[model samples]
Target: MSASLTLVVLMAVMYGTGVYVMLERSLTRFLIGFVLVGNATNLLILIMSGPSGTAPLVTGTASDDRMVDPVPQVLMLTAIVINFGVTAFILALIYRTWWLAQLGDEGDTLSDEHADDTEAATEAVFNQVDLDDEAIQRVLDESNEHGDDSHTTRKGAGE
Candidate 1:
């Protein structure tokens, strides 16, 4: 088999794996998939340039047939850097999501059983309150007695 054919097969497998993992709910799996896809793309770029015959440096005696293309190598280097940045950004997003959810698990935390319980408790509390009733009038009267302004003018020009 040719190098190009092998590279194509490898890239296809990598992309397939990445797509499968991306559908998963785990953040770690998602990151792994992203890395695999990135590496496959980099390898594809290298393979498309054909075999590297010689060094890119000008030795003054090397022939054109012996010289290899340097553009692919340069592009690969840039791609690697960009991939690193993307991975870092993805990790940061996962960390932030974890912090907000107060759990180490990835995906939607609201789908968890504990979140359902919390929602039920909140609903129970809200059900006891009549928002349109005169109970709010007593609360507003107390606030007014404490010198609280229900409608105050702002000093800003936007108001």
Candidate 2:
């Protein structure tokens, strides 16, 4: 059976709105968008499953065409479980962010401790490697002065 136009339109709207909401910086909005997108995917699967039919296990049913397809239902259930899991994970993240925000003087900003830690980590990585352009150029020049043959020895031309 053909999919209904109304459901298709609704699904499209849901998908569009979900994507739009997901672009926001707020974790809550992202969670809402994720849920909307998940439900829209379920609707899409339903629309594509075709017309409903009798149970596949029903006794005395001789024709396989009349049996309902179970794949779509299974997929929908799987999607639901996955959505729930991701929602929980997002909630946890939101809670963690809120907790961190609370520790700072600003209502929405991270604490100075976190910022200092981040800066320290970044400095540690770059300073340990001496990643500045001048240092890199000096290292390259030193390696050249050492000679390329340091890595490999060439045989005599006649030997």
- Evaluated with TM-score, which candidate comes out highest? 2
- Where model 1 places Cα greater than 4 Å from the true spot, the runs are 1-5, 103-159
Backbone clashes (count) for model 1: 0
For 11-107, candidate 2 gives per-residue lDDT tens digits of: 9999999999999999999999999999999999999997999776757647766888889999999999999999999999999887566443433
Name the runs in model 2 displaced over 4 angstroms. 58-60, 105-159
lDDT tens per residue, model 1, 1-159: 147777788889998998888789999899999999899889888778777687887778847668888999999999999999999999999998775675333322355667666556655555666554567888888888655443442324337
Q: For model 2, which pairs clash?
A: none
Q: How much lDDT does candidate 2 score?
A: 0.83
